[model samples]
Target: MGYAGRHVAALLQSLGVACSGTVRNVAVAPEVIRDAEAVLCTVPPDEDGDPVLRLLMKQLRDSASLRWVGYLSSTAVYADREGGWVDEQSDADAVDETARRRLLAERQWRALARDKGIASSVFRLPGLYGRGRNALVQLAEGRARHVVKPGLVFNRLHVEDLATAVVAAMRRAEPEALYLPCDDEAAAPQAVLAYAAALGGFEMPPAVAWDDPSLSPALRRFYAGCKRIDSRGTREALQWAPRFATYREGLQDAFRG
Candidate 1:
């Protein structure tokens, strides 16, 4: 059902939900698609477009039992707001090539759901961190970076928050909905790194300018745009609130555990 199929399956199993998973081949096994009550797609778009949609658009469209379809998209779809606020309704004219493709995929998924008359939602998520995936893990393993870009802010969401939002969206059975699922506070990259270092009892990594020659091109591109994501529309629609509304609370949980 997703790229991180095993992780997702484990999470659902812990919640007492019987789940099955597949990686990158849901199209070949129509039975899996047919048997699924809901399908969550977490794959990223390629240069050609959404691989899942390209492969299984017909199967998904023909799925009579499919009650809900959720696509995990990125808030990068939004244009660079320069640390300003963007909500579900904001303009999504992203200049980045990957972001543009993501936006296209979002529209395609929504259109498919609309045509099939099924409940569907697209989640525009920010940088995701939780459990073993947070900054603490990075800092502990000596992989953390303090990339400094002044006046830049990025929102993040715990993986658990995303799971909660998905469940809420499914239960609500809302069709053709767009949501931004993010934490309460938006902060700079260095701030998160410093906080995580403090929580992990490690020295803060020295700041590196975004333009430093050692940075990877992908990392540089990640810091190219700055924006704060707002999830109020999603909160009101799903009646869901993030448990870890800020990086501080989330990092503390990770550190303690």
Candidate 2:
């Protein structure tokens, strides 16, 4: 949702369209924003259905003149594959707390949009990195570990790429469509950490087995599964491509800063 708002807001402002955003605290103020030419919802769904979603839907439905509703979701909602690949067409088999919660949230928002009669699309994003957000800095600071979770690989994207995807979707958002936003490469966690370590002029972090008792059971389970997402829908539909294709290039860019 943050990705949607930060970019879409600028996009709106660039076009001279009056815009207003809502959070859990400010959703009730839609009346103040009712005059907005477009309403791009960046609100995320809770583990349960978002209460504000119903309210937002009601407002969007009741508003006399409103256009555009976008829902932000996670690619983590995709089923864990134990190192298999998934696409927008794949089923969701959430394997951990975060993924399970996100899957539930995606379902709730889709249901709300259907019942409320709103034009909405969901963007499923991969691991996000940009600016100061890349893992290189963390690994450089000795906070990141290249865990040898060999079976798992994940697609990643820069925030700028994610931003452009949202803009592209808005340029052609339909009533109900699911979009997967990702870049070309999928790397194991250890691989990304190793790259980050190299950027910091250090050796890779020690390998830690998932069953190591030193690691919390919950965290171990979180790291137990791997996911590789397909981004063909995003590439074909949006006619988009990523600037940072791999961690090595991306980290070098990050390090240069």
Candidate 3:
């Protein structure tokens, strides 16, 4: 998400629009965001990988002077329906502890905009895939494992699309808007990995099930997640199209070099 923000921020700036990026829990260098107009925040691993939104609302409310505040949120805030599809209108269950914590933060930010009159918006993004972060690259290089879990699927968006949606949110400058951002396809873990390897012009590597007891708990939890989400709203509202609409498309570019 951080990398995606840089791409979008630079794009917006190149178009003659000044942009500001806020960093949470760190000393932001003045030069990183000296020229500013709108503020886009993609702060995380939220103070231990999930900071409550109240802290940010207080911090943001304390500082003002921007046309809009764009919050880069995650679709993990949605409930785990075990492969069932979820949309922006769906109720978020925040199944695991981390997601539950993220949900609380989202509620706080939404309230800050609605009741307190802060010009804010929420962008719930699906699983992100992009340059240097491609799962196949990670798996092939031994940084990540590709394990399939029953009843777990993932929706993905190329970072370019995520960045575009964020820019669209900022462009509209809506006082309090919520949008679900995702790509055109939802795929299983093995499917995503195989596609990446295919793009690399290599045969798909074999992998064990996530249920294999040899796996670590953290990896197991990550493999257990079902990243199903809908993004009709982004296309309708932003009038934006992704240059890399699918992970396959983006993965090809990542390995092309």
What is the C-alpha local distance difference test score of each model? 0.83, 0.69, 0.68
For residues 169-225, could you state the per-residue lDDT of candidate 2 as single tens digits?
777756677888777788887887777776677777678876788888776766766
lDDT of 1 by residue, 72-179 (tens): 888888778887899988988787888878988888888888888888988888988878888889888999898999998999988777877887887888888888
Error of 2 at 211 (Å): 3.3
List the candidate numbers ranked by lDDT, top first: 1, 2, 3
Error of 2 at 59 (Å): 2.3
Off by over 4 Å in 2: 1-4, 11-33, 37-44, 54-57, 95-100, 115-118
What is the TM-score of each predicted model, taking all chains together? 0.92, 0.83, 0.83
Q: After superposition, how far is residue 90 of candidate 1 from its true place, in Å?
A: 0.2
| Candidate 2 TM-score versus the reference | 0.83
Question: What is the Cα-based lDDT of residue 44 in candidate 1?
Answer: 92
- The residue ranges of model 1 lying beyond 4 angstroms of the native Cα positions read 1-16, 24-28
How many residue pairs clash in all the candidates, one count each?
0, 1, 4
User: For model 1, what is the error of residue 177's alpha carbon versus the real structure, in angstroms, after optimal superposition?
Assistant: 0.2
In model 3, the runs with Cα more than 4 Å from the true position are: 20-36, 45-59, 62-64, 201-205
